[model samples]
Target: MPTPALAIVPLSRDDLPVDTVELARFMIGKYLVHDTPDGRTSGRVVETEAYPPGDAASHAFKGRRPHNGSMYLARGHAYVRLTYGLSYMLNMSAEAVDVGAGILFRAIEPLEGLPLMEARRPGVGLRDLARGPGRLTMALGIGQSFDGRDLCAGQGLWIGAIETAPMPVGVTTRIGLSRETDRPLRFFMPDSAFVSGPRKLLESF
Candidate 1:
């Protein structure tokens, strides 16, 4: 029998709009596929945070550099980086050309190819496998190795289409950071057993 093909779609830069909030919400439940040179792995997005160009907390808020220049390249590119010299964090570039904005993947719920994920992060509990942003990156084999990769083309680790269920009620907050210190822009699936951390209840967006 012939090898089965995955229902993958090449997400073009144009497919992503400039609306950061909508992009964050839309990304919820979608499958984030990482096709590393070593192998292929994936997971379901359960949490995300949107950051605008001028936001004080955004990495590209001030300007672009060799480190974050990818965020200004264009949409649909992966803007990954190491956090605290420990774990990797995955991000999808957003906003129009010349505008540096992106969505931070805070957490994911392991879906398909989990055995591969567990093998990657041995000794981690199944429930805590992909809970944190850094943990998820490690679980999916996303590291400096996948930096600057094009997720839209499915050429590298890319986002795949999946049947998304209704979004759980969530709240917005000034994502976990010491900067900006005042923007309530974080979003997550409330009451989800897969949440990486505790849920915070806030009013207004």
Candidate 2:
């Protein structure tokens, strides 16, 4: 049976927080939706990591370049990029234009379009479908082409929200980073099984 579509309110630029760290925290419990010819896939954001302006771990730390120019766009825009030459990472541009900062979508709880996500990630369990940054993009079919796209546009790939109440949020340091690893910029839902990373991080955060 086809999955029933979920009702989501499209988020606007005004709905986004201007501060990078705040935006990262705000993303928790929000919904991410991708409309495609095949179908619509949606999930509830359960994890996020902030790369604020001037953070050495941030791509925009050195200043804006051609490839990372999208990160400098005004808040509520897509700044998709590829990492490890294998997976695509999806991010939301934060802060005003010319100020490079972003929030990386780390994980989400699958809410709609399970078949599509399963097809993209065969053999992956439902809890792990969008369990990490790379898996989240792959499961949602988001790619580099989405870079510079306005997420507030309410079409194609975009972030949305339902009327559900917020969940308990947890804080922890970012994972798999060499620099600035001590900063507690990562946020996630303490109760969500869909959230990725080590069991200790999930349990302790």
Error at 185, model 1, angstroms: 1.2
lDDT per residue for candidate 2 within 1-205, as digits (tens), equals: 3454777999999998889998998888999999888889999999999999999999999998888999999999899889989999998899998899999999999989999999999999999899999999999999899999998999899889888765667888899999999998999888799988853453332
> Under the 3 Å rule for N, CA and C atoms, how many clashes does model 1 have?
0
After superposing all C-alphas onto the true structure, candidate 2 shows an RMSD in angstroms of 2.2
RMSD values for the candidates in order, in angstroms, are 2.8, 2.2
- The ten-residue window of minimal lDDT in model 1 covers 1-10
Q: Candidate 1 lDDT, tens digit per residue, 1-205?
A: 2221456455566666667767776677677877655566767677888887788778898798888876775677788988888888988887766678888888887866667888988988778888988988888888776766777786668886644457554656655688876666667777666776657767422
Best by lDDT: 2
Measured against the true structure, the TM-scores of the candidates, in listed sequence, are 0.86, 0.94
Taken over the whole model, the C-alpha lDDT of each candidate is 0.74, 0.90
